[model samples]
Target: MDRLLSIEPLSAAAFAPFGEVIAAGAALQRFAINGGTTERLHALARARADDGDVVISLALAQARQFPFEISMLERHPKGSQAFIPLDQRPYIIVVASAPTHQPHAFLATQGEGINFRAGTWHHPLIALQDSSQFLIVDRDGPGNNCDEIALQPSWWLTGIDAG
Candidate 1:
């Protein structure tokens, strides 16, 4: 039988199982800096890779229409991955619990992003409506950290920003 998952609004507690909800105004140690010109939030979350070195890069992801069909889930054993949107557009996050393959989904809000835990199972970035740019933070070096599983019947994001 085929599985269809309803998309859910991204939240800290709900998403804590797989990763974190990266929201700026959501209680992450804010402090005034540089004569109050900047507010610095401390230690939002930790990003890890097996190699212990992280690199910042930009990825341009094309838009995928609604009721997105999920074909596969991939994971990085070496380190964690974080996606920060530069276009301030909404996006989809599909993840599943490791070993058991219990799936979870999320929709990123404005000024919000996510950091996938190292070795966490997740789908690649899904942009909604239009093409989007993201700040990608993940492990870099020589290592077979990436792992993937292609779904048999495949799952789908049935609902848009619902549930």
Candidate 2:
């Protein structure tokens, strides 16, 4: 048997229990940069990589076939992971609260990204529409940073509206 989930729109408040949504126009400190050429949203969230170095990298996530199904989830015990889309394409964001590990699904809208809090249980990078690229900020050092668990009965997410 498979557990089905309807993905909701990703929001900072809704996703607060698991992580922070990295999108513009949220309630955050803002300031002009480079003499007003660019605006900056400051101090969005704490991106920590304790005992490890913060490394910047890019990842190419391929789109999964329709009828998206999730059977497993992973977490980083040592650091927080941030994914910012390079092409402004929507993607699937699956996370679970601690203790119960109840799964929740969200679809990122255009020009949005997310930062998974350390130890946050989440599905791997899932890009929709087409293969997408993301700038990844994560930990890189000695430590068991990853833990994977098989979701009981699995989950199928559909009709994920991106808003």
The model with the greatest TM-score is: 2
Query: Which residue pairs show collisions in model 2?
Result: none
**Candidate 1 structure quality by residue, lDDT tens digits, 1-163:** 6788877878888889887767775557889999999988766668887756799999888878766788888999899999989888888898988635657878887868899999889999888856689998999988688899888778877657421
Cα-based TM-score, every candidate: 0.91, 0.92
| Model number with the top lDDT | 2
RMSD of each: 2.2, 1.9
| Total clashing pairs for each candidate | 5, 0
Q: In angstroms, how far off is 132's CA in candidate 2?
A: 0.4
Residue 157 error, candidate 2, Å: 1.3
Give model 1's TM-score versus the native structure: 0.91
Query: In angstroms, how far off is 40's CA in candidate 1?
Result: 1.0
